[model samples]
Target: MKKYVEIAIVLIAWFALILQLIILKDSLANYFSYFTILSNLLVAISLTPKLLASATSFGKRFSLPKTKSAIALYIFIVGLVYNLVLRGIWEPKGWQLVADNLLHVVVPLAYFSYWVVFVNKISLVWKDMISWTYFPLVYLAYSLIRGYFVNWYPYPFLDVNKFGYQQVLINTFFVVLAFISIGLAMIYYNKLMTRNR
Candidate 1:
């Protein structure tokens, strides 16, 4: 049941993302403009192995790094932050509205559920949480560099051009704090879950 649910969510995420691409057309020339897409795509694709594991021996062997769990947590944060901070700004309509909710709301819930209910337990540590920062750090550098070149920023908080480096950096600091907090919770939650089991 969980496997089927994951497969369905992954399909919905990908299909909606593709539809968004068609709708936005030229606007998404730089696909990385939205972290929602990057995180959702990564988490959805990463989940394919687990979703397929019930059927294929190859999927069974598709062992992934435990650190991928951090990506799952991060993607959940993406959805959380978007709905909390950015959703009202978009005011989407029709299919845009549908796609927005699926990508930024439904997909995250689905992936997090898969993680909690289906994924095998892996030992987690503070070091694993530290490793999670690397991806977000690299993404920040990439977004800043790309923004400098293209004069576009993905999120208002990170728009160095408008907010300038200092303000953007401050915003980034808070975001990093949020990431670390959630990462710690994830590590501890995994430990507790294992203990209870």
Candidate 2:
């Protein structure tokens, strides 16, 4: 029963993502919003066992990550601070921006929390990391092709035409660095927690 529910959530999320991608076609904002939600949803599904176990008597047996969850929590906190302090100062009434940023922070934190508390198993490997990297790379390429055809970019950091190829390349480099750093940290943290148990 639980497995079915989990599978259903995963399938529904992917279905929505695919539908949005096909329907939105040229709308960068729509594509990105759906993609982000889909990624978070997939992560949540992958970590659901940890989330459920954490609520039961076997919670302590799961041996969830301390450091990784701490980092994810901090990221959520920083995002909130950025929205309240920086974004608020720039545009006090930017409700849409606030909402969007909040969702971005919340979804990832929720996924991280579930991973640390309920899912004690970590099956990630080099192949998984490569697969994760591939999605972003492919998405970036697709975004570039779409931008070329439609003359618009989804996110400011990815807007090559506005920022130029060199700047976009620099931004991509930083993005990849950030991804690798965070991913390695999480992997190490998970391994440490599991070993200590």
Candidate 3:
């Protein structure tokens, strides 16, 4: 049953992503620049092995509790930040609406549900929250550098041209802080679940 749900999530994520890519076919680089796309891609890629239950080294590594938890954290952030900051900025229509909701809403909720129910929580630790910071920080650096050359940003919070560097830095700081805070909360929830179990 868990495998089935994981497979469903992987399919939904890919479908949404493909739909998005087709919509943005002319500006593929801009399409990939969004953290939402990258995070959903990670969810689809990381969980894909669950369908096969493979014994390969890559499968085993991705199957680890840490890897699962990190992907969950990222996808959760995608949903969180999107709903809170970007949801109302523009209205999507037609196939774009389907792609938007699936990528931003369905995939995040489904993946997080899978994590809470199936991923092992006993092995998670407080320091894992700190380790989770690496991906977002690296992504932030990448976005800023890429935005420098491309003259566009995926989200307004990270848009230096609009907000200027200082404001963008402050925004980045808060965004990273949100990521860490949510990570700590996830660790707490994991420990709490473990204790109650």
Candidate 4:
């Protein structure tokens, strides 16, 4: 059942992403544009550990377990922020609406559910929480650099041209803080679970 659900999420994400690009039409012209959006990057990020867990033992290697939980928490943040802060901006219709929800809502829930239902409770530590922050920071650095060159921001809060670097940096700082909070909470939860056992 877990494996099947993982497969479903991967399929659904790809299906929605392709359909969304098709619907956008104009955005399709810029190839690099596709990877810039956080939603696309997140679904792909969320997919990695799921795929790793089921098909191979790679997820347990190269600090992949740390990365997995971190990405899961990040995607959770993505969905939460979208639903709470950003949902009103897009007036998607029909299939676009479906795809929008799938990407923004469904995938995030599925990934979280996968973590709760499928992931073994590892005894987590402070190092795990610290390790979780690396990828997001790199992503932030990359996004800022690219935004400077291309004037294309994936999220409005991160748009330096419009919001300016100060505002965007502030937003990014909060996001990083939130990531740390979530990572700590995840570790705490795992620790509690281990204690119970």
Judging by lDDT against the true structure, name the best candidate. 3
- Model 1 worst lDDT run, 10 consecutive residues: 58-67
lDDT of each: 0.77, 0.52, 0.89, 0.71
Candidate number with greatest TM-score: 3
Model 1: lDDT of residue 108: 88
Candidate 4 C-alpha error for residue 103, in Å: 0.8
For 75-171, candidate 1 gives per-residue lDDT tens digits of: 8888878978887776888888888888888888877777777666466667887778887878878888888998988888888878889999999
lDDT of 4 by residue, 1-197 (tens): 86687678778777767777777745543433432245445556456565666455544452255655766787787787788878987798898788778877887898777777776658457787777777678878877887788778777788888888889889999989988888788888888887898
TM-score of each: 0.88, 0.59, 0.96, 0.81
Ranking by lDDT: 3, 1, 4, 2
Candidate 4 stretches with Cα past 4 Å from truth are: 26-64
Better structure of 3 and 4 per TM-score:
3
